[model samples]
Target: MSLRALLVLVLLPLSGCVPRIEVAAPKEPITINMNVKIEHEIHIKVDKDVEALLKNQSGLF
Candidate 1:
């Protein structure tokens, strides 16, 4: 075989592996605002407080 023919066969397969790539940037700016405000309040009222109820054992189960 000739030197030119051997060189062409070894290099031809390598050309198919290279790929073209492209990249693009966004046109508008990105902004995020998360101002979170959380509030929790618990109010409880019971009739005949605990002292009066414990004094009388009639309601005891």
Candidate 2:
């Protein structure tokens, strides 16, 4: 091949090696806020009535 054609072919691939860059700047400060609430309740029951036992035991003494 001719020297001119060979030089053109070699330089074609070098054009793609150039780098590209982009930059951005922030204009305001960032802020975040969060709120949470929790609630709990419990209930219990006796196997036998407690008031009747106290009443029966009072007469035994």
Candidate 3:
């Protein structure tokens, strides 16, 4: 390949790596407040048959 063709190929990728200029607009500050409340009441009742099966399980051995 020619030197001009190789130079063009190398310079094309380098051009894409150039940093772009950025302009940021000014903004006003804001304040926010939030209040949250959570209440949980759980009651679990197990029957005698399920309690007996759980107590006699061989997997515990």
Best-fitting candidate, measured by lDDT?
A: 3
CA RMSD of all predictions: 9.4, 8.2, 12.5
Rate residue 38 of model 1 by lDDT.
94
Best first by TM-score, ranked: 3, 1, 2
Once fitted onto the true fold, the runs of candidate 2 whose alpha carbons sit more than 4 angstroms away are 26-61
Worst 10 residues of 2 by lDDT: 43-52
Over all chains combined, what TM-score does candidate 3 have?
A: 0.39
Each candidate's clash count: 0, 0, 0
Model 2 lDDT tens row, 1-61: 9999999999999999999886867778677766767777876665466766867699755
Error of 2 at 55 (Å): 83
Better of 2 and 3 by lDDT: 3
Task: For candidate 2, give the lDDT.
Answer: 0.80
How does model 2 score by TM-score? 0.37
Residue-level lDDT tens digits of model 1 in 1-61: 9999999999999989999797978789878899999999998656777656866876776
The reply for model 1, stretches above 4 Å from the true place, is: 25-61
Q: Rank the candidates by lDDT, best first.
A: 3, 1, 2
